[model samples]
Target chain A: MKLEIELIYKQYVDYIYGFIYGMVQNKAVAEDLLQDTFVKVMKSDIDKIENMKAWLITVARNTVYDHWRREKRKLNLMPFIRRKRRDIDLKLDIERGIEKLSPKLKEVIILREINQLNYKEIADILDVEIGTVKSRLNRARKELRDSLEG
Target chain B: MNCSKIEELLSPYIDGELSRDEIIRVERHILECKNCEELLKDFQLIKEKVRGIEIPQPSLRIKKKIIGYARPRNYFLRIIFSTSLLTGLGALLVLTLGHQPYIAEEKPKEYYIMKEERTPYMEILYETEGDYILTNYEGGSL
Candidate 1:
């Protein structure tokens, strides 16, 4: 309710949305989870939070993982396809490549490249050591190379 | 380190995350190794492709929907709490107060079962008043 928190929400809403949308690849679900993320932040005691951005990303990442677990049970019977819109089709191809990544590698690539979070930020979000974050990122890059090439 | 070691570090090297010493080693190795040189080209190609791909913007409807959820966070939670309280009270009332009217509305039918406890003894025969009877075991006059 404070002016600062409201301003923060307004400023970062789009960035958080873009980051989550990149992970989920669905507009409706992404929007729902985005609202959920902000709602959680607003309800939490901010005095305890040292890094708001990393905390928000961590919340968004958990929401995405839960969504994935729920959807995986639904057993999607449809084959993956690049939709007809030229730009979207191309984008969809890139998305498919990201989807093909192992979960660990995918998370690293998404946090670093798509979310544009620094290595230290990603390290905090994932609750891993910095060296582990760097190594995972490197492996992710190599895997993305193989996916794009083959 | 050998070509394999340098090749393993190429991704981190490109990301500018490697230590200064590792950077120098990797750079020196790539200068001599053509295979790793090709690997670097392939890595760059992938990074460019991923970075260049445009991310789709969230639709306007989704934007409005998300904003709608955020706008009523406090009010929505209040409503949920009140509704839950009402639901619990209603259940308590229904459970505490027995369903008298509900049970009264429907009449239960009655059923009976028949059983015999004992049977009477049967009479074997009857004798006329004027008729004389003699016992076979002893002689008698009547």
Candidate 2:
């Protein structure tokens, strides 16, 4: 069991971490989600997962969405308070542009670009059609380019 | 292929996801259409920038924590092994002290206070057991 986990960790840790970090954009939260993702993997029946990388990414994405949903609920209960915005860093323009994208587009971009997954792999991870993945990737790039330029 | 269709294909072309026929068609269209060419460049730039964003690695501590959590039996064994080692050491210490009344001294606990200004949305303050206070302000508090 230990060897199995070590092997899986060696193979997928960085990819899973990158995917979660892209989704959450917070180091601490991303690390927590990464931990949660691995724990889920450890608990799951490994023999059943035919595509390990895609399965891991799917789990990571779901963990991120679960975190977001929990945060949204907490925000709903909290009193509204206005806060000052920090100056945007020029170096982070592209990242911020990605952050500005809609969730669907942002996810496709992350899976494709950051994680370097192919369209078919991304489709498998996202449970979407390959055509949908292509369109989303195209739309995501266009939106990101426009945001950076504007 | 028209410019709009070619534009849509630009991302796939950059990703090397296009088939032989589609790639030939998009390349032919891009060579003639300046707008599509520029759009292709923009897509390539976006891909580069997204790929360039540094992905932070999860810390070793987090990795150990996850592993420990996943395999609680191993962790429990570790705890037991360490405790046993400590107990054996303590037993040796007592055996060597033989009738020399040993007085245990309590050391004063040291406290560290930290204040961090993060973004601007949320402020959190907490106190440690040793009277150390930490105040943290973070932006985009959910």
Candidate 3:
């Protein structure tokens, strides 16, 4: 079991951490959520999981939402509170664009772009159909582009 | 489909997620539509930019935390130990209850079967002086 945990952590720590950071955009918060996600994994039946990477990402996604729920009062004002300190770098512009996206779009883009998961994997993670994944990804890409262009 | 619907397909087309027909349609539309072709270019650029977004690495403490999480717990060890102990006990009980010394209280059924084979015309004799003698019904005993 210890070996199992170590092996899993070693194999997936970076991607899982990157995913959380991508979704939350906070190093501190992402770290906390990563820990929380692993803790939840530790408590459950890890041995029975067939797809560890997908499962970990799913847990991390849930952890992100759980954090949002806990911080609902503060987060509800985030869009209004978040002031634009736009960087000229197109990369930074898109990152900001992604940050401003609604959670549904945010998740699909992050899971698709950052994690580089296929449509099927995104569908599985989001619990939606592949058609929905495709449409959401298209909309997400367009929104990000439009947000930066305008 | 209109340009917007065609535009909706640009992402999947870029990712190679579109079906063959959809891909053909997107390609055909892009050949004629300047706006969508440009939008496709922008979406590609956005995808590249998103990929370019600096993925932050977690602090060393998180790695340490993960390593720390990998440490063996007493409960896991306890569960293994208990399971093995129960299995051993079960094996022992099966061996104890199922195994016994065999004793033949009477002649085996095969002996009676052999004895029953003798008939009015059949002959059976022990060496020299026998337990019984069987003779032909003509009764010429030699």
- For candidate 3, the TM-score is 0.71
Tens digits of per-residue lDDT for model 1 on B32-93? 88988888888777666666656666567554544444433468877997899999999999
DockQ score of each predicted structure, in the order shown: 0.10, 0.40, 0.22
lDDT of 3 by residue, A38-86 (tens): 8888888998899988999999998998887766655464434332233
Give me the runs in candidate 3 sitting further than 4 Å from their true place: A75-91, B75-142
Please give each candidate's TM-score: 0.66, 0.76, 0.71
Q: Give the alpha-carbon lDDT of every model.
A: 0.67, 0.79, 0.77
Ranking by lDDT: 2, 3, 1
Which 10 consecutive positions of candidate 1 chain A have the poorest summed lDDT?
Answer: A78-87
**Segments in model 2 whose C-alpha atoms lie over 4 Å from true places:** A79-91, B72-142
Candidate 1 falls in which docking quality class? incorrect
Q: Rank the candidates by TM-score, best first.
A: 2, 3, 1
Winner on TM-score between 1 and 2 is: 2
Per TM-score, the best of the predicted structures is: 2
lDDT of 2 by residue, B1-142 (tens): 6787787788889999999999999988888989998999888888888999988788998888666654434878879978999999999988889967656796666856655422223343243355545432232221
Which residue pairs clash within candidate 3?
none
| Alpha carbon lDDT at B113, candidate 2 | 60
With a 3 Å backbone cut-off (N, CA, C), the pairs that clash in candidate 1 are none
